[model samples]
Target: MRVTELSFEGFRNLHPGRWNPDGGVNILYGDNAQGKTNLLEACWLFTGGRSFRGAKDSELVQFGADYAKLGMTFEAGGREQEATITIRQRRSVTLNGVSLPSSAKLAGTFCGVVFSPAHLSLIKDGPEGRRRFIDSAYCQLKPAYVGALTDYQKALTQRNAFLKQSKELGRCDSELLDLWDHTLAASAARLTAARQRYIHRLQPIAAEIYNGLSSGREDFAIGWDSPIAEAILPEMAAQWLDALRQARRADLAVGFSTAGPHREDLTVTIQGQAAKAYGSQGQQRSAVLALKLAEATLLQEVTGEKPVAFLDDVMSELDTSRQDYILNHIEGWQVFITCCEPSTALKNTAAKVFSVKQGVINE
Candidate 1:
């Protein structure tokens, strides 16, 4: 997919103007806090996800403005489409002139993948971050997976709330707990199986890219580590039910889930050592880039349309060769990358460079 036109009003610090980015690479460069990242964030909002920077809806509007308005025109699936978002207390969305109940409804309709500085936490942080990384990408590829994930999360929430209350009561309701456990396990099976398959597809592609990024000096691998093994995917519900029963005591002791999808993690390794534990700063950054690029590749393979890439402040702290590799690896994909200083040498003649300063953009 490629974005042809993007306009924003009262969005963060950006001025009310439209930017027509090149289909290849569009670099938004300026000093820190000059709205470069904000420009990317505005484009990323079309992905139907919340702020990648973790900002709230109210925070997206300028200080004197009561709301934010964002609009974009893009081509995908052999056709051109237009989308607009009006942000107040919540995001109101319109796609192809049809209104959507919520911005979340725009997930599969208009898709994009984002890799921000915070995404480095996918490797440095705990398991939750890795799980989120996989699930978020997977959700775009398969819409049904969204229902499975929602069901699992809802059931997990109820189960945890019961666990907390049971702990307070000093005694559990066995019958009620049994029903809840079965419900939770069923949803967990569906969600976990989907996660496993995603990781299986993601691993090889990511490893290959990491090899290219490292010049074959390092070996990168990804694995889905679950409480139940992969050999019995069809019987996962029953197996998960048993596992939940077995872990009930420990779970109640902790007043939350002790095992299952929520507790599971994606194990990332480089040369047989956990990247989080053994990789250097540059190695970790390259690993993240490989994973994100692999995510974009997977999206294209499954959906037949390459999702736009938003790399916010991703060029910082990388070597010259690696910085160029990020562009080389995604030659055909539409990219919006942010950096403080984007010298003309960073991109070829075909690529577009936009100067951003004090919320203004000039190409």
Candidate 2:
């Protein structure tokens, strides 16, 4: 997919204007806090994903502005389509002039992958980061996964509230707890199956990319950590319900439901050791890079259209060899790169360069 036109108004520090980017590499260069990342954030929002930077909708509006509006025209699946997002007291999304009931409907319409400074946490931070990485990618490829995730989260929340209330009252209602347990088990089983399948598909691709990036010196593995080990969905649901019953006493003591997909994690290992605790800075970055590249490839293979790539000043964080490898690798996909200085390698390529100062963008 390629974004042919993008327009923004009252969005962060970006000037109210439209951008027609090159279908190949388009580099946006500017100093820190000059709205370089804001431009990319707009593009990411068009893809139905939450802010890669984790900014709230209220925080995305410009200073003194009450709302933000973004419009995008892109080509995907051999056709041209338009998407519009308006953020005020709430968010409203429209595709092809028809209003959408929920933004989740926008997934797969214009798929893309993002690489920002925050992504480094996927390797160095806790398991929540890795879980989010996998879920985000999987949701785009399979929109039904979003419903399963939402259902599971809702059931988990209700179950926890019941646990807390039971602990406070010193008595628990077995029938009420059974209701929540059944609901949680059903949703959890679906979510666990989806997550396990996603990790299974991602492992080989990520391993190959890591091996190439590391010159076959490092071995990479990805695994899903879950309490339900049954391969069949019905059996998994039964096992989850049994596990929840067994953990009720401990969960009540703690005032929370502690056994479900919400507590699960994704394990990344290098040379048979956990990467999060043992990998060096360089190794961690390499692993993250491989994972991202693999994500882009998987999206294309599943959708039959290459997802747009947003590189938010990540090139500056890599060495010359790694940078060269990335630039050489992303050939067919439309890439929007933000950096302080346009690298010499990019200057020699067919890249469209833009300079940003304050809120203005000039090509």
Candidate 3:
């Protein structure tokens, strides 16, 4: 997918503006807090996800404005298409003049992937971040997967609440627990199978990319760490249902549901060691980049079009060689990269450059 034109008004600290970004690399350079990242955020919002920076919807509106409106003219599915998002009480979307049920419906129609400094948490933090990374990557291609995720979360919440009530009342509801067990079993089984399949597809590509980024000096591998072992849905759900029954007393003791997909993790290793514990800072950064690039590659493989890449302040931390790889080596995708200042790696490179100052953008 390519963005032919993007425009926004009353978005965050940015002044109202319009941009027609080039099909090749587009660089957004400026000092800190000058709306460089905000521009990328605006483009990414068309993907129907929340702010990559974790900002609330209301936070996207400027201080004096009542709402933030964003519009995009993009090329996807072999034709030019349009989408708009208006953020007031919440985000409302219109795609090619057809109002969508919700922003999530924009998935598959306009797709992109983003990477920010916070993505370091995918390696340095706990399992939740890694799980979110894999799921978010898949949800972009199959929007229905998001429904599975929501269903799993809802069932988990109900089961945990019931667990808490039982603990407080000093009473057991075996029948209620059984009902939750069956519900959790189905949702967890389906989600786990989907995640494992995604990892099977992702692991080899990520490993190859990481090896290339590290100049073949380090080996990279990732896997799903899940409790349910069976591969088929019926068998896996049976496995989980039995596990939940077995774990009920322990779960009650802790006032929460103890065994399910929520507790699963994505395991990442570099040079046969846990990247989180032993990898160097550069290695960690490279690992995340490999994964992000793998996401873009797979999106292209599935959709027959390259998804735009938003790399926020990524080059500043990378060494010269890695910087060159990002600035000049990646092929065939529209890339938007932000930095505090341009680097030598950008020298002799053909790219459209935009400078941001005090919320205004200059071409």
Candidate 4:
């Protein structure tokens, strides 16, 4: 997917303006905190109406403004499309002039993979960040996964509340607990199966990309950690139910449901060593870049359209070799990169460079 046009009003420090981007590499260069990332965030909003920076909707509004408005026109799957989002007390989304009931419906309409400074910590950070990476990519490829994830979260929340109440009251209702257990187990089974399949498919792709990034000098592997081991859904559900039953007493004592997909993790290892603990800073960054590229490839493989790439100043953290590898690899996809300086190497490539200053964009 390539964004053809992007417009924003009352967003961060940005003045109301529209950007017409080239289908190839489009570079936005500016000093720090001058709305360069803000422009990329606007493009991200078209994907699923959620900020890749994890900003709250209200926080995206400009100072003294009541609301923020964003519009994007993109080409995906051989068709031109438009999406708009308005954020006030609540957020609203529209596609092709028709109002959408929820932003969840926007999935797959436009998809993108983002790389930012925050992503550099994926290896050093906890498992939650890695898990989020998987879920975010999977949700875009399979929208039904969103429903399953939501249902599982709801059931898990309700189950935890019941556990807390039972612990407080010193008594538990077996029937009520059974209801939640069944729901949780069923949903957990589905989630585990989907995650395992995704990881299995992603491992080789990521490893190959990392190999190229490292010039074939290192070995990389990814593994999924889960409580359920059975390959079949029914068997997995049964295992989950059994595990939950066995852990009920401990869970009650702790006032939470402790055995579920929410507690699972993804492991990245280099040459059989835990990447999180043993990998160097450069290694970790390479792993993350590989993962991001693999995610874009997976999205294209499943969706038949390349997702736009949003690089938020991550190039500054990489060495010259890695930077060149990335710029060379992302040839067919539309890329929006934010950087402080225009690299001399980029001059020979087909790049549309723009300048950002004080919320204004100039070609």
> TM-score per candidate, in order?
0.94, 0.92, 0.94, 0.93
Candidate 1 colliding pairs: none
Candidate 1 structure quality by residue, lDDT tens digits, 114-195: 8888988999999988998899888877877888988998999999999999999999998999999989989999888899
Tens-place lDDT digits, model 3, residues 74-120? 99999999999999997789999999989988878888878899889
Q: How close is candidate 4 to the true structure, as a TM-score?
A: 0.93
TM-score for predicted model 1 compared with the true structure: 0.94
Candidate 2 runs further than 4 Å off: 175-179
Between candidates 1 and 2, the TM-score winner: 1
Question: What do the candidate models score in CA lDDT, each in turn?
Answer: 0.88, 0.89, 0.88, 0.88
lDDT tens per residue, model 4, 14-127? 999898999999999999989899999888877774787789988999999999998988898798989899889888999999999887688778888888877877889987
Q: List residue ranges in candidate 3 displaced over 4 A.
A: 327-329
* Cα shift from native, residue 77, model 1 (Å): 2.0
